[model samples]
Target: MFRISVLARRYSTKPITSYFKLFPQNFPHGGPPQDSFIINPKHLRREYRNLQSENHPDLNGSAILNSEVVSNEASLSEVINKAYTTLKNPYSRIVHFIKVNHPLHLDLSRDEISKDLIKKFQSKSTQSSLAYKEILMNVLEVHERLELATSEQELEELEVENEERIEETEAEIADMIKYEIKDWDELMMTAIRLKYWINIRNGIKEWEPGKPMNLTH
Candidate 1:
């Protein structure tokens, strides 16, 4: 069986700088990079312990004379903390995976939202944003269709279709994000679609009468 304690100790003993090098791109915004090495909970806990041990000032005693040791240790600990945070949560893990591996060329532009649609979304009442409401309706329609799916083959087909829709929607959102589009009308529409599919996917996992909820739930 894998052990988190061993992994943590191993990582912590390495020079603090080494951790940053392990995931340099992930820390573009700040201090130290997260521990991307963890692939499972066991690995996660091990890394956590290693970081705590190495950073504890008392461990070094009088052996190290540099004042920077404290700061470095603090930074290392923070990285471990962020890693745990990302790995522990399913949604965060998905987002992190997208950030790390998805193609950067994915467009983020306002062009995906036509002017007529924007007007419709903006003109609606506040009960729920018009765009979001529509997206939810779409999701519901798809889900109902999925429920009526006749066979394993039919269900598989629907799953493929839904997956395609999600991919297309995500690409549209990427375009919007890339261009820094500030149009609430456009952003909300894309966000609504994204959230709708996410919920639908989660819902499918629990559709069976007595099955336990999936990790996302």
Candidate 2:
């Protein structure tokens, strides 16, 4: 199991810079420099617990530090919780990575990836543009099918297929991030696809007979 004690010791005398810095083990290349997409969830959870334990405001109260440092510890504790959440989910991790390293590549926001945006992308001929459009279309198709699905078996079959799609996209994302770092456009499109697939997976998991599908981008 991985622990955050190394990170704590390394930064004990200095101000913590970024959330990514709190878990050096997860991104050995250092924050945005890390190219890999996979992380061990078990390790992440363990590291999170260790980090929270060391940084929790109660653990670093005024008895051990000045008022200013205690206040900062409270804020740091909150940030530690958020960092754990962002790094635990692959989709959010990708978003954070791009936001930090390649801000311009995020062409579309969640609200912008609707029917109107799909039609707009159709006019563009770039590979990334086409790929984004195809992903959006597929997500729409799946949404329609999910809304129309009548029986548990139909939903189950869709769940299996969508899970497979999610796995395939995850692998593609890992390869792209590792070897196609310069292809920001393609990577962004693939990341968007993965996001939608994850949303669909959640919708399937929460499905209830006769209830409308609740798939969010």
- Among these predictions, the greatest TM-score belongs to 2
Query: How much is the lDDT of residue 97 in candidate 1?
Result: 36
- Can you write out model 1's per-residue Cα lDDT over 1-217, one digit (the tens) per residue? 1133542343212222222222223322321123332134565466456546755543344422233333554664565566556544433433443333222211112233233333456566564466456655676677776566555676567677766776677666555544333553455455445555666666554555343333210
Deviation in Å, model 1, residue 121 alpha carbon? 4.0
Q: Name the candidate that leads on lDDT.
A: 2
Off by over 4 Å in 1: 1-23, 26-134, 209-217
For candidate 2, what is the lDDT? 0.66
TM-score of 2: 0.69
lDDT of 2 at 73: 43
Alpha carbon deviation, residue 199, candidate 2 (Å): 1.3
Q: On residues 21-139, what C-alpha lDDT tens digit does candidate 2 reach at each position?
A: 56656665656545366778898788778767855643454432332333444775676677788878777777666655552323234444323334444545586467676777899
